[model samples]
Target: MSAPPLLVHLDGGVMTLTLNRPHKLNAIDNPLAQALSEALSSAAADAAVRAVLVLGAGRAFCAGRDVSAPPTDRDLELVQAVSRQIVMLDKPVVFAVHGWTVGAGFEWMLDADVALASADARFKLPEASLGVFVTGGLTATLTASAGLARAKATMLLGEAFGADEAQAWGLLWRVVPPDALEATAREAAQRLALLKPEVAARFKRVLNEVGLARFDRAIALENAAQQALQTGG
Candidate 1:
């Protein structure tokens, strides 16, 4: 039997999905992304998963999209579909970030409700620096997290930041030691889950609307700005 693309574990109204690609730093490969999307959908409809926590099994949260395979239409579509689904999921999706977070793997959590970073974690938006102006909606999200000037510096300059720095800059809600990340995240999720599941989920949905619409607007602004930068406006 083939190993699962992701691991799903549900307990006490909290569903935690582990991106189980430690060997590849849990990069968002095609199969893993599709499975992750489906898992989010499943957790949303289960009526039992009041809150969802997404994390990686090994050293990293996600090292971005797997560039091992040549970029293709299928690859792009899969990632895009999963990203949209992540944004559409009603349940709150929290992330536990460790190691490197880049590319689509970073995009997946960009659609999350909240993020907790390990002290050792580092984040960078290298899409533009890689000759690709925009590979994901992260420029906007990261900008929203850290502000326009910081966002521009990070994305355009391809700067990387430590976890505590991320929190101070508003890139993450919280940061903890590497060993404490999972437990801390789980405790936080469980606290939210202890409340009425339906109510919690509804709150998540409403907050998503408020946050995501702004997120879209921010991304649009970034996109237009990026276009101008590339087009010599």
Candidate 2:
């Protein structure tokens, strides 16, 4: 079988993190999430990597968390931790989504400086259908992206949207054909790598504070909920 997904490749000034579990549609379990967090943190700590690119190994980017794994608060923790890291990273992060991005996996995109997706890629947020609140800060980011009405529809309907619809709704930065996704996004990442990492970092900071003000509040709320569950509250 192909090596387990989650490959971290470092080049001249860019770090590419590939979600390798294509067989499982790159599901994010605790270990995978932790690995992603560690990899992202490592990239941020390294001075040579000015920009980072995240892509899936095979067809899908991420099919959300693997529910078959024993459920635990750790699943949510892993995603939130990595998301916080992405939001706080000193370097730029560009998410290149190829196939599916559902539930928690969709929230990961919200943390990126820019998100590019293949035209064949799909998106959805189905937490409500599953009877759980989102822990990846999608509760807040969705409102910013699709407005309260569209966001509510997503939660209630839990249906998938194609790349065109996603881009039109401001949920994606750019969309191209599946074959062109990596090349297109990597080109953008390469350009970003040429800039001062601090510039992208500062832009990310200010954008969160100004444009995405509610993100901080959402994460705080999520953390409290997680802690309460941890304490059996």
Best by lDDT: 2
Report, for every candidate in turn, its global Cα lDDT versus the true structure.
0.75, 0.83
Q: What is the Å distance of residue 135 in model 1 from its true position?
A: 4.7
> Highest TM-score: which candidate?
2
Q: Assess candidate 1 and give its TM-score to the true structure.
A: 0.86
**lDDT comparing candidate 1 with the true structure:** 0.75
Candidate 2: segments with Cα more than 4 A from true spot: 223-233
- Report residue 75 deviation for candidate 2 (angstroms): 1.1
lDDT score for residue 155 of model 1: 68
Candidate 1 ranges with C-alpha deviation above 4 Å: 133-136, 214-233
CA error at residue 72 for candidate 2, angstroms: 1.0
Model 2's TM-score against the true structure: 0.92
